[model samples]
Target: MTTALFPPAPVSTWLVPLDDTADGVVASLGLARPEGAPASWLDADERARAARLHDATDRHRWLVSHVALRLLLGAALEVHPSAVSVVREACPRCGGPHGRPALGPSAGRPLRFSLSRSGGHALIALRRGLDVGVDLETATAGTPSPAAPATDGLARWVRTEALLKSTGEGLTRDPDAVALRPTAPGVWSEHVEGDDAAGPELVGPAPTVADLALPSPLVAAVAGPGLDRARVRVHLPATAAA
Candidate 1:
């Protein structure tokens, strides 16, 4: 088992790369195929949505990668694979609502998780007693270049947007409704409220955003309580099982 160097109480984040190798693809696919698994394992709406993307290549890859991440994280927590289940929910990627995949009744433990992938890498975040969200982008010629500097304003905007997405709020509603405040180095706060309606007031403290050191063009962000210690673990397909 890969030992977590940090204290046990802190959040653990793992970033696994999906290489083009056969093993990498296989690992990812195992999670995508429902196979003999119970249909009830997924949420009703999520099952319907996944059915539509069953034949889509990009969607397949994304689902597989996400499943693999969930399995790995569950294992890390010493939870049995069969006891870990994901609810299929409509998680929009770009400007819509802020939502993260939910866990089934079997996953009622305090651990929370989120998944995101871009280019060829899949990122997973796992934390105890905190609502966590993670996003990763792999560097590729077709992807945004990391060498380009990130403007302070742009970084703030992207971080807040990502945080909102994690919270299940619709991103298309109003960008001006949320405010991001810099609290410390690489740390931010998200101040959210209802827009013109009696919407819920949200005040998330100490959200953290960091630039990952992946060889590819990638940006990873996380928003949650007690996320100051969020750290990334990189795993290649060959070494992941070990």
Candidate 2:
């Protein structure tokens, strides 16, 4: 058997491309389609919301995110994927259930995770005892051209989004208000939290932020505790059974 790239304890990140054909072959991941997986796996409101997405790609991305999350959590918790519970907690500022998703009360562990997708890519970051957030963006013609004077702008955007996501506020918080400057090679530390902002932080210590290198035109970053010890593993569709 191929060596399994299991999620490490306490903290780690997984970068996966949503290229797996959704051909009803998630059995190796211990997932059950059972007709209403999306409607049932997602919270009621989210299910209805997902239904309103007119584009098939949008709908498919939603399904992959939720299903992948449950499967990962199930592997970590040693339970069947279908047995895992996910909750979209209320917005910290609005008290509405449209904020970041979290593991439900029955999960029995403080499994914090963040999900982000852009273009054809997706990223999932998880940590056991601290909050975590990840953002992925595929560079396109609209992004600052590599030769543009301010070429680092896209990286800054991902850093800000990752920081906001770590706080569970996500893009709901003004991206302009959060500032991240390069601290070192591959690392960008939070430099400012503008007005209408709280301090930049996660569940515990200041989160370590760093860019992730991928094989595509994607730029990814993650923010969370214990990240200095974190490892990123790429799991392709064929490796699910490993």
Candidate 3:
């Protein structure tokens, strides 16, 4: 991919071995208001969303989140930020408009991507010919319960979130309803479970899940069909990396 980016900043793309099928890349960026993003870059809807965030800090973070997202997407597609068109796919389970956001009518082969943000950072993931999902959660300051402290339970929760996003289920399925267990290093096995007359939790279709190597106070995971063996290239912006 070409490095034609806005603000003329250097971005790093780091590669690691993990793929059995779909090739992937993930870009990490700081959400603390980046340079070169004009208020005019946002449309009415985004502006409305930003307006809802009355706090100036929150508003700037939201704006920069979008700026980073557009920049990352633009780089992946090799187009101007304005040229990247995104459309929502129908929900796989409910057949509704509330589903994964994907690149629409763009150049080259259709690439699957996922975006996740937490605290002061964000992640954008792109994969070739495979559905992918990612989730990032900031650790709790004092006693982070489900998603903080980087405990086993927190890891389970993030995995559930990533899997749900991958399947376009979102919160429609309760996080507590999924059962997860570690099956390998930096990986977990999960299945949708429910009570039936036959048993307490019935095992169902499960997705490939793995933990991300982010720092403390920030836990993350990604899911897909073949992520158990995926080559996820994690990219850091050159400025932030230094």
Candidate 4:
């Protein structure tokens, strides 16, 4: 079994291998309602989106997840959290503007990140020069999303999610066309794209994915090209687990 990363002691910064603080990937898992997290940390648009969530818990979790994402990115870039700017790149499939979420022009251009939250828990991950994707699911969460559906189970589901997100072909790509082949324990190194077609990311080798060991009922995974699963680290409060 993999080691659980969530519910770690409340840590300020957990660094991965890097030349400076800005060079390495950072992944964090935390309770959605962190104490004293001000909604003002989010920009006007984020605050408005959070307010649109009908459920109180959903709204709170959305706020915390976005806040955590900005903070992590800001920390890596050595900027204030509020100074971070977010934008979405054009879709890889049709060149539409509603593609994967990305850093704006002023932010680190090569950095790629992904965020997923469920069951009042949030996971955020980012890496410089390499695209990264992450997914988290609670057992109570009924089914995998249709965008990246999995008939097998949770493990395969999250792994596939990381795959699609990393490729930046999200929602537009057909899931049935891509198949994962295992290369190591808890690791997937090969995926087949449909129609003999490849996206911008698919021009490279198949993405590598590793299942994350989270506390019970929470399954997670991260994917990227030539991913060093050991280097991905996450921090959480000690009291986060149910």
lDDT accuracy of residue 203 in candidate 1:
72
TM-scores of all candidate predictions against the true structure: 0.63, 0.77, 0.72, 0.75
After superposition, the stretches of candidate 3 with alpha carbons farther than 4 Å from their true spots are: 1-37, 92-94, 106-108, 145-152, 192-206, 240-242
Model 3 vs. true fold: TM: 0.72
Instruction: Quantify all predictions' global Cα lDDT against the true fold.
Output: 0.53, 0.66, 0.60, 0.64
Best by TM-score: 2
What's the lDDT for residue 175 in model 4? Answer: 54
- For lDDT, candidate 1 versus 3, the one ahead is 3
Q: How close is candidate 2 to the true structure, as a TM-score?
A: 0.77
**Top lDDT: which candidate number?**
2
As a whole number from 0 to 100, the lDDT of residue 8 in candidate 4 is 24
Ranking by lDDT: 2, 4, 3, 1
How does model 2 fare in lDDT?
0.66
Please give, for residues 1-242, the per-residue lDDT of candidate 2 as tens digits: 11143545554566554545443325434344444443355456556777899998887777666666766676677676667777788887789987888888998887788888775556787777788888887776555734223546777777778877887777677777666767677777666556446553345567667787776577778876545533544343335434
Cα lDDT tens digits, model 4, 1-242, are 01233222211222222111111122222222323335555688888888899987677667767766776666566566677788888977778787989889897456677888766676777777777888887765566544334434667777778788888876577655556788877788655456465444455556788777777677788888877666666554333235
Which one wins by TM-score: 2 or 4? Answer: 2
Per-residue error (Å), model 1, residue 209? 4.5
What's the count of clashing pairs in each model shown? Answer: 8, 0, 7, 0
